[model samples]
Target: MASLSVPINPLPPPVNRRPDVKPEISLTAKERDEEKRRQKVNRKIASQKATSMKLRSEATKAVIGDKSGPSNSKEPLPLLENLRAHIAALRWESALNVFDQLHEQLWYRPDSDIYIKLIVVLGKCKQPEKAHSLFQAMISEGCGVNRESYTALLSAYSRNGLFDKAFSLLEEMKNSLDCKPDVHTYSILIKSCVQVSAFDKVDSLLSVMASQGIKPNTVTYSTLIDAYGKTRKFAKMEATLGEMLREGQCEHDVWTMNSTLRAFGSSGQIETMEKYYDKFQCAGIQPTIETFNILLDSYGKAGSYEKLCAVMEYMQKYYFSWTLVTYNIVLEAFGRAGNLKQMELLFRSMRSDRIKPNCVTLCSLVRAYGKARKAEKILGVLHFIENANVMLDIVFFNCLVDAYGKVGCFVEMKGVLEMMERKGCKPDGITYRTMIKAYKKGGMNSHAKELKGSFASVQKSSPGLERQNLQHSVSRFDSNPAS
Candidate 1:
């Protein structure tokens, strides 16, 4: 179309020109390389930190063992075992340390159940302050609080005989609806008060519970009856039991009967024990294994071997499975009756029944053998235990020493002491007293003096343990047992 003067001017670069532009201040090659190195260093440091934290988290969780997790899970086995072992051994110090480690974990979250358990363990170990610290930690961690946890901490304080602190905590719980004191709480407090013979405090606590409209349950009444019976306050014991039978929230159970019988049995009131036993039986409360053991113990201690034999016959006729405790009671009864043959026979039967003998059973055997002038049998028992890989506790060693001493085997008795040292078992006060008595009887003044010196050293080394030893003297098994 013709001769149009088409002046298409040369195109200018696009307006943005991003591809052509360079930064105002560009990095030199050296600067760029330095920046790359810095980034690499930072990444390496961060990776190391991440690994460190991961290891710490694993270690912390390992201590706790995540007991709430499935029991069959294998990953937390060792930690779970550690927890159980420490708690079973009543190693409160180790347990608290483990608890602290658990809290320091990276993935750790507060848990009420864990705190409740720890608090209870601390109460058992009589470490009230540590328990209170755990409660404080639970609060600071923003965990849910409940009456059970409060009751646990209260128990700790009560066990330690910090009555004021316990009451203060109880009052504190009263003010907090979420952590209000229940029958268990008052029961624990009442038990503690009764333990220390603080009857006034007990009365006041009962009054407070009534005012608070918290009714006493079976446990509360059982604890009261047991405590009162222990103190020989038969009137109070009978009254509490009567109240429980009449108007208490819970019915009388085997435990109350046991407590009643124990009180009478411990005081050599076998007739009263039997009467109460019959009454309880008529109340539709079935006898437990513990019941039979208690009866056997009372009869044995009262020198009513005929009654003990009758009870054994009844148990056999009823096909009641003999527990480790039952075997121990029978062995002790036979031992006290000076029927060494029967005791040894029962010992064999105990093993055949697959019920492993504990220290109490072994002690009964030792005392029996000692009485029969068959001290050699004790050596046999030691050998048997070694062959069976049964753990040798200090009590067993003490029993060994006592048996040898009673037989006038001073050399063997001292050898037991040496064995104890080699086995890392510490000789307690009972051990020292036993050896000293034997030494004096043997007219070995120098040996007795030497033992006295060592005994003093042990006392110095473990001052707190002396009180615990005294408490354990009244062991769950009869204190004046066969051994």
Candidate 2:
């Protein structure tokens, strides 16, 4: 201590020492608190803006009604826009109401698109008169009508069995409107003529189309072929196909080939159908499902299991994916051939392939099982139908009831009837007749009498009930004249 003091020469007055000084921050507590509050407010404002932008985007999309891409254009005026939306949604009456409002409020400008849309809607709604009136109004307004407008009207009339109206429209399209009858227009008119079995008109239409330089497309050829086939005029069908080939304008497409095959099949001309099947491929046209279905159906109807199997094998080899109709055709073939084992195997295979059997398939199987007197198997099919939620139509229900009744399983038949009623499906005359037949076979005369009465009542209530009742009654009377 004494040595240190000797080196310090009169130490300066004790320097005032202070603790380490911290940097002086600029913000005060009040300013920091204010800054935090401002930040929170800015975040809230940004969030609100983002939400508003999202809402606007959704609203814009709703207005534009496009499947893809952004809708930039503002929606059309409210009345017209609403009317269009209603039409798009198929709310025909509502759309008509809007149209009426539009006519009253806005100036009545004959917009071709609107008129077309209205006509289509009315036609779909089965308001043919309204559709016709709209068409007349459009013409009166001097609106330019296109092919679609005339075609739509013609189709409506055709569907309703108004052949005269359909023909008149066709003539007007050609004569008054000066719209050349294209293949489509001609096809519609031809189809209508065929529906009415007006073979003469179909021939005339085809000739007219040919003379006008309007080369018939695949549809035209298929329609004419179908018409000729319906009337069992195979010679005409052949001549038509020959003409198509000779014209150099039309080729033998799959549809034309299929139509010819169907005609042959329907006429039980299995040999001819097979010949054409070979020729179809030789003509450099690929066979389609329609071709296979026609051949298979023909073979099935003829109970030719060998031919059906051959066709199915060919289908598999060609990698043609089997459809419900394909399976149904084979099922029917096996059924009619009394090849129950093969039919069952095919039905099981259908399920294994994840192909759900439709009403047609089930009906075929039920009919087959009934014919084989396999009541249990038919019940199993009914359960499958239920499990798959497959809706049973009149034909399906009739088949099931008949199958159960054939085996004298009154309980199961009644169960099916009750289930059908629960599902709001009214049994047709065939169903009642089948039930009566089963009751009679089982010697349950009381039930048979009741069912017969019900059948008569149903027929009386609904006129023109497809004549299934009359056919069934005749068969019953033929079998048991005493009844």
Candidate 3:
């Protein structure tokens, strides 16, 4: 077979060619070395940046007590505890500051529960503006905007007397999907409404709850009972109680019993109170220390010394440790009865039992001494006050002024104003009224007139003083054993 002549052309010689490639590929040796140096520098810069970020994160964790690790199973415990501690202490600014630091953490996640808790704390601390800000931040951070979070913000507004805002939020919740107002939400709002004596609002909230097929829980019924009792709307309170009992699902608890007993007892309905107390006990609700305290306070106020003594004896036999309220009640009872020897004995016993006398205790003593025209005994109380570490409030100072006035110690009576000023408690209407009355009684018409003029000036300077004074006086009276 004849082989065909193959004319295969030789390939071109291998050429040192870079076919329009990237600059680095076409670099000369020096250019290549320079490119390598530039790459190393870029890598070093990146490493330094990563290190700096890590160091900054570590520093932040150290400062804010956020000792988080790679495991993301739980939140940073130290950080949470620090924030909770501040919140519990009512340190609003500190709590928010810690919260901000928590947000900047690498492991931080926007949590609705945490936001809700802070909102609640701010509400209790009367910082509704801060609570709303936190709520907005929660939404921005993609946290779930559910009923609980909304209710928390609503509570913040309502508890602080921002009812208009609270109602608006309620309406918003009603219109929102999956965030409708529930029993707890209505209960919270109702409680706040009751606190501010907005009974009409409370009724409306209750109606809404009923319409929404949300049955009132024990807390709701108890709150209504307590509020009605406080306002002396006995018929309404009784009706509410009846409704609660009619609702088979909502069982009465110790709190309900306490409210009922307090209502009757405080109004001097001893027989009714005793009967209900027995009924509550029969219903398997055990009385607590608060129950007995209420009894003692009621009997003491009614001047039923025998019953008060019986209650005290019963508490002792049952090994119920006496609280400060108990001591104050008993001390005030004995003092009002002019049993100075017994009052003094109880005072000594209170101190022996490591119960430091508070403003209420001292006020009782001063009042008793003043009533007995024993100026020297009042001075002794003053000496004790000076030695002891009791925080005195405006109420206590007012009592001191009245005591000095009763004993015709005009100079000391006048000095109380200065003391109140030093303590940063401005004089309210009751303060001026008390001094004026004292001056009138002491045959100092000029002094009384001067105080009247000052009172006018204060009223002008602070328009809300009268209303606040009335509230303060009512609160003081409610707290007083004599009431």
Candidate 4:
């Protein structure tokens, strides 16, 4: 009965609220105020973060050469695609320009992988400073700093022969908590050292790797073997191969086989090269087109025409397609053998096969024609070059000069410098040396002396030119040596 008598409004009327209820209402208001305050604080924090990121990006852009604001026209994907295309084309400056454009896009996000790719491209283009700049920009953009990023930057420096910077960076990587050096890091450094023929440094790096319990991989052994073979360090090369074979984890690949073949083939050790080729075959490493090219090149250089022809026949028998390098190699071989008629036929055949001739191909024609004293043929090559979209480098220009000089085309020989200037290729010490030697051969002592004075000035300014010229004189005396 008492429960049924409970009032509908037991507490209070509208103006007679209890004190406890007043406290409850106050608590709800406090919670509302706290939520609003919390929201305001969050907004302030987000604003500060956005401003900091914007400022950091601005600073990074200032360092990276583009100060423009975000572009609204191009979408992010297209911009990124363009950047990748330029990089793949080996156009370093163009790639950087596209990267700048990408940075100016509103939807752009910093990507460590893209930065690493750009850095690698710059390294290949011999633009270590630019690569370093991009690496710094990657860090400033708040991109994740990891082993890959450090290795890429290290590779850039190493590729450019900046060993000091490379070593310092390696030390830095060692000190990094998140980016300790790995086998790939040591392998890359070893390859760089091998490239410069700095065997001492390579040994030091290997010892360091061993001390750190990092074993050599296939790439590392291959690099060492290739370098040693190229440098005629047979003992070291064989030792490296032996060590690689002993490592159960490092199975021999096609590259390894090619390196071995190339080492012996390039050194004119045909017997040894053939032996290794057979061994590799027995080891189940199938030969690639590069393998055939290496064998052909070696045999061609050593005047083993029969062997070269044998390799060619084998390739044809196997239905293997001829690459541009294959065409260049055979052309050079025939050219060197004074078989111009066959060389011309092959050249025509190469074009019919839609393999456009490159600088190396043109160089081969010029050198062969020059040796045979066919000035007209050299002229024909020049005409072909004018029509073709082949990219000419300093080596090609040197060959052109030699060809002209060989055929007593003094005027044309001198004109190559103008061609070089137009092509935006600076003449190296080899270029000057070739020209000077040609002038002296032509009995133009006065001109030779003048060029000699200029060369002296160049050497004085560069300090390294004389050494480079000496090496060129001793080792790379031919206009169109094997590629």
Stretches > 4 Å off in candidate 3: 1-75, 411-429, 444-474, 480-483
Estimate the TM-score of every prediction. 0.70, 0.71, 0.78, 0.67
**113-176 in candidate 4: lDDT tens per residue?**
9999999999999999989999999999999889998999999999899999999999999988
Q: Each prediction's Cα lDDT score?
A: 0.82, 0.78, 0.88, 0.87
Lowest lDDT sum, 10 consecutive residues, model 2, at 474-483
What would the per-residue lDDT of candidate 1 be over residues 326-364, giving only the tens digit for each residue? 888889888978898899889899889988987778778
lDDT of 4 at 444: 98
Q: Whole-model lDDT for model 4 versus the true structure?
A: 0.87
Poorest lDDT segment (10 consecutive residues) of candidate 4: 64-73
Residues 357-408, candidate 3, lDDT per residue (tens digit)? 9888998999999888888998899789889978887788888888888889
TM-score of 3: 0.78
Error of 4 at 95 (Å): 5.1
Which 10-residue window of candidate 1 scores lowest in summed lDDT? Answer: 474-483
Better of 1 and 3 by lDDT: 3
lDDT of 4 at 291: 90
Instruction: Tell me the deviation in Å of residue 156 in model 4.
Output: 3.0
- State candidate 4's TM-score: 0.67
Better of 2 and 4 by lDDT: 4
Provide the lDDT at 342 for model 4.
Answer: 87
